[model samples]
Target: MKHSITMLEKTALAICIFIALIAAAQPELMTEHIQPVVQDILSFLGSGFFLFVNFLLFAVIILSFSPLGGRKIGGEHAKIEYSNFGWFAMLFAAGMGSGLVFWGVAEPALHFMNPPLKQSLYPDRLASSLALTLVNWGAHAWALYAVFGLVLGGLTQYSGNSGDICAPVMSAFGNKLSLRKKRGVVFTIKLIAVFAVFFGVVGTIANSTLLISKGVEIELGITSPLLIGTVIVSVLFVTYTLSAKLGLRRGVQSLSIFNVLLAFSLLIWLLFIVPVAPIMKIALDGTGYYLQLLATGTWQFDSQLNTSTWATHWTYNYYFWWLAWGPFVGVFLANISQGRKVWQFILAVVGIPTCVTIIWFSVFSGAAIEWDKLNQAGILSAIKHDYTQGLFVFFSQLGWQGTILIWSSLLLLLVFVATSADSAILVIRQLVQNQFKNESTLYVWCLALFMCSFALLLQQDEPLNRSIAILGALPFLAVFILQLAGFLKEFVRDLCA
Candidate 1:
C-alpha cells in the first residue's frame, strides 16, 4: 500500500523535524532566548484566556437547550458503534487519564500553600483549595473540547474520513474563501494543534515516567536509577503501541474500563478509610463556592497582587495546556460519537466527565489537605522538596499501606499513562493520514512520538518544552475563536431552515 503525501502534512513534518533538531542540539538557547518573552506575553493575556474558558462553559450549556441541540449529528441512517458506557469510558480515558491522576492530589496541595487568589477574603484555605481545583478541572475545560468535537461531529457521515477540525472549518467557509487561502489557513491551524498535542503528550509521558520512577525508588531500596526509568518507558511504548494495534473497541476500550475501575476502587477505599465527615464538608463548601462565583471569579485579574508567577504558572499554564489538548480530544470524541443527537454528544463529552472530575479531587486532594492539617505529617512540606514523589507521599498517608495496595496503585497509573499515549498517537495518526485503513501510519506516529518523548526525557528542560507548547497553544486559542464564529454562523442558518 502506497501512502500519498500532501503539502500540509509535508510542511508540518518538516517544521517538526527542524524544531526537533535545534531543540536537541541547543536546549539552553531556547530557555534563555525564547521562553522568557513567550512567558511574559502569555502572562499578560492570562486573564482573558481565563474568561474565554468560562465563556465556553456557558456556551455549551446555552447551545444544549437551543434549537441546534434538537438537531441530529448524523442522518437518520447513522449507526452507533459503542454503547454509552463504552463511549464515555474510552473518550474519558483519552481525554484525561494520566494527567488527572498526577494532578488530582498535587494541584490542590500546591494551591493551598501558594494560592493565586491570595487577596480574596475566602476564609478556610481548605475549602478554597478544593474549589480552585474544581474551577480548573471543571466544566470550562471540558467545554473547550466539546466545542471542537461538536464542530466535527458530522464529518464521519458526510466525508467518510477521519474526523479533523479543519474539515468542519473548511466546509463551513470553503466556498467563500479562495482555494489557496483556505488550505493554507486551515492547514496552518491544524499543524499548530497537532504540535500542541504532540508536545502535551510527550511532556505528560516524561512527567509520568518520572513519577513512576519515584514511586519505585520510595517503595524499594533503590535510589533514582536511570535504568529503571528507561525500562519503564520502553515497556510503555511497546504496550500502548500493541494496544493501539488492537484498535479502539478491543484495546482502548478494555484499558479504559480497567483504569476507571482501578481509580474507583482507590477512591472508594479512600472514602471509607479517610476522615469521611471532613472530606464531605470540603466537597460541599468548595463546590458551593465554585458554583457561586464561577463567572466573576474567572474574569478577575489583579495585577496588584504581584503574584504574576502564580497566575502565569498555575491558572494561565493550565488553560494553555487544556486549549492545546482541545483539538485532539475533540476530534477523537467526535470520531466515536456518531448516531447520537447533538445535545446527547455534548452532554456526554462535556457534562458527565466534569461531574467525575469534582468527585475525583474531592477524594484525593481533599483527603490530603485534611491529613496535612490534623496530623501535621508534613506530607505537603515534603512535596515542595520533590514534586515527583507527591503521589507516593499521599499514598503513605492513606489508611491502607499493604504492599499489594501500593503496587496496585502504581500499576493502575502505568496503564492509565499508556492509555493516554496510545489514544494521542491514534489521534495524531488520523490527523495526518489520508486513509483510515493504513496501520502503517499509526505505527509511524506511535514510534516517532515515543522517540520524541525519550529525547525530551534526556534534555529535561521545562522551559523549552513549555515554550514550544505555548507557541502552539496561543495560536490555537485564536483559531478556536474563529471556529466558534464559523460554527455559530452555520448553526443560525440551520435554525432558519
Candidate 2:
C-alpha cells in the first residue's frame, strides 16, 4: 500500500509538471490543430448521428426500462431523471458558462459587423452576420456536446463501471492488442485521457481566471488587478474544494444551484430591461440564416485559398477550444448523469439547453448590435481592441441603470468563472487520483492552481497560444483512432450478433 501510494503521488506530480511544461510551451496550437479535426469529424458524423443514437437508446429504454442494452448487459435504472430545471442547470454549467455570458452578446454583434463568406444568404450583411453567429453557436456548438455526451454517457452507463471515461475507446480497439498480455495498453490509454483532460482543465482555468480578474478590475477599479483577482479566486476555490471534499450532493450541488440562480438573474435582467422584441426578431432571423448555412456551409474547409486563416480564426479555433473543454466537462457531465437513458441524456444535456443558448445568444448579441446601431460605437471594434472593454461599451449603452445592471452582470460573470474553475479543479483532482469521491485533494487542486498561475504569469511576456495548440492537437489523433475503431467494432459486432 505504501509503495502504491508513493507511485500514485509521483505519477500525479509527473502529470502536473508535464501539463505545466506544455502550457508554458505553446498554448494556441491545440485550438489551431486538434479542434479543427474534431470539427471535421463531427461534420462527417452529422447531428443526425446523435438523434439516431438517442432514438435507438430510447427504443431500448422503452423495451427494458433498465440499464440493459437489450439484455446483452443489464443494471439498475438511473437515479436521475430529465427535467426542465435539471436540463437547463446542467447545460448552463457544462456549456462553458462564461462563453454564453460573454459571447451571448459579443458573438452576434461580431458577426453582424464582419459577415462571414457568402453574404448572399441574408438580405443584407447585418442579417447575414447574425445568421453566421447563430450557425456557429446553435448548430456546430450543440452538435459537439450532444455527440460527446451521448457516446460518453452511453458507454459509461452500459459498462456499469467507473473507470476512466476513455475506456470505451479501448473497447472499441479490441483485438488490436492482446488484452491478456498488454496491460500497459490500458495504462497508456488512461494516461493519454488524463493528459488530454489536464490540458483542457488548465485552459479553462486560465480563461476563467482572466475573465474573472478582468471583471473585478472593471467593476471595482481594482489596481494591481491580477493580484487581487488571483487572491479572490484562490479563496473561493479553497472554500469550494473544502465543500466538495465534504460531498458532491452537499457542496457541489449547492454551488451548482447558486450558480444557476445567479446566472438566471442576470439573464432575466437582460431580457426584461433590454429591448426584447427587437432581439427576438434578430435571433429569429439569425436562426434562419444559421440553419440555411448549417445545411450547406458547415463542411467548407478549403485548403487552397488561405483556408488556414479561416480555420485558425473560426472553425479550427472553435473546434480546438471545445476539444480543450471536452475531457474535463465530459467527465463532469458523465459523473452527474446516472440512471438516465441515452436519448433523454442527449435531449436534456445537449439538445434543449442548446436551444436555450440560442435565446441567450439572441438577447445578448442583439443587445450589443442594438448598442452599436444606436450609439455608433463600433462595439465589435472595441471587442477586437480589448474584449474586456466591450463590456464597458455595452454598459454605456444601457445608460445609468445599464451601468448598475452591467456591474451586477459582471459580478455574475465572475461567479460563473469561479464556479467553472472550482468544478474544473475538482475534476482534475478526480483525474489525478483516479477517484471521483468528493474528498478534498488539496495537493492536486493546489498543483492545478499553481500551474494555471504559472501559465498566466508566463503569458505576461510570451504567447501561450502555440503551446495550447500543440497540446490540443495531441489528443485529436487519438480520439479519431478511437472513433474509427468504435465505428468498426459496432459494425462488426452487430453483423456477428
Candidate 3:
C-alpha cells in the first residue's frame, strides 16, 4: 500500500547498469563467449523446451473447455476494468507487435527458399514455410504467456498479495518451502526474472532500432549508425517515457489501440495489393498443415527427424526467444486481465491474438511467395541480404504507392516498439519497487532500459543482443517449472475453498 524501494529493487537497478556497461564495452567479446554457451544450451534443452511449450498449449486448451474455465479471474462480481477491444489491443501490442512486424515477411520467405525439412518431405513448400512461421508466432507462444499470466494473476488475486513475480509463487508454495529456503529461492527467482526482462527488452530495443533505421535508409538514405541510433532512440525514449508517465490506463491503452488500428489498416492495404485468392489458399493450407504436423514438429529434434540443424536455428530459436520474453509479457498480460473468466482470458489471450497473427503473416508472406513466382526472385534476394528489407521490398511491389506504404510501416514499427517499451518499463518498475502505481522510480527504470538498449543499438550487433536474451531465459526455465506447480496448487486450493 505504501511506496517504498527495497534492497532487491536497488540490486536490480545496479545489475542492469552493470550489464549494460559491460555489453557496451565489449560487445564482440561478450557475444563470442555468450553465443557458444547459448548454442550448447539450445542443444541440451531443445527437446525439453519443445515439450514444455506443447504442454502449455494443450493445458490452456483443455482448461479453457473444462469445468474450471467457468471461474472468473478476479471474482464473479468484480468490475471489468477495460473494454474488450482495449484489453485485447494492449495485450496483443505488448506481447507480439514488434516481432511480428520484423519477421512477418522475412521468415516465411526464408523458410520457403530453405525449407527446414527436406524438400521431398513437403510438396507445397510455400504452405510448409507459412506453417512454420505460424508455429513460431501462433498459439504455442501465446499459450506460454497465458500459462504464466494465469499463474501470476490467479495467485495474486486469490492470495491478495501481489508484488514481484516471486511473491505470489511464494504465497502459493509457502508451507512447503522453509522460511530460510523460501527467502533464498525468492531472491534467486526475482533476480532471474529481472535479468531476463533486462536482456529481453534490450534485445527488442536493438532490433527495433535496426528495422526502423532500415526504413530511414530506404526513405532518406542516411546510414550513419550514430545518427540513426540517436534519432531513433531519442524519439522512442521521448515517446515511451511520456507514455509510461501517463500510466497504463491512458498511455499504454491509447498507444495499443492506435497500433492495432494502424496494423489492421496496413494489413487491409496489403490485401488489396497482394493476390487475394492465393493468399486465402495458403492460409487454409498452412493452417491445416500446421495443425496436422503440430505434434511431430513439436519434437523436431528427434533422431528420426534429421532436421536438428534447421530446427535448432528456426523452431528452437523461436521457443527460446518466447521463453525469454515470457515473464515480461506474462506480467503485463496478467495486470490487464483482471475480472475476466479463466476460459475467456485464455481464449482471448491465446486464441484471438494468434488468429490475428495468422492473417497478418498469410497476407504478408503470401504476397512475397506470389511475387517471387513472377519477379525473378528479387524480393527473397533483398530479404536474404537484409531481413529488415523484406517489408520494404514487399511494399515496393505496390507500384507508386510504395513510398507512402513504406513510411506508414515505419510509423507502425515505431508505435509497436513504443507500446512494448512502455509496458515493459512499467512492469520492470513494479518489479523493482514490488508495488503498483508508484511513479517516483519510473524514470530510473526507464533510463536503465534505454541505456542497455542504446548500448546494443550502438553495437548494431543484432545477433549478439539476441544471444544474450536467449541466455537470460535459460535460468528462468526452472522458474517456469515451479510456476506450473504453484499454479496447480493454487487452483486446487481455490476450488476447495
Q: State the lDDT of candidate 2 residue by residue for 127-228, as single tens digits.
A: 566665555455455545544544455443323253245556766766677866445654555455555555554555555455556656766788675586
Candidate 1 residues lying further than 4 Å off, grouped into runs, are 5-7, 155-162, 171-174, 301-309, 398-402, 436-438, 459-468
**Candidate 1 CA-lDDT value:** 0.73
Residue 41 of model 1 has an lDDT of: 77
Cα deviation in Å at residue 326, candidate 3?
Answer: 1.9
For residues 342-363, write the lDDT of model 1, one tens digit per residue: 7898888788988888888878
Scanning candidate 3 in windows of ten residues, the lowest lDDT window is 155-164
Which prediction has the highest TM-score against the true structure? 3
- From the highest TM-score down, the ranking of the candidates is 3, 1, 2
* lDDT by residue (tens digit), candidate 3, 285-369: 8888788667675655454233666566667777888888878888887778777888999989999988988898898889887
Worst 10 residues of 2 by lDDT: 67-76
Give the lDDT of residue 30 in candidate 1. Answer: 64
- Model 3 misses residue 344 by how many Å? 1.0
Q: Tell me the lDDT of model 2 at 213.
A: 60
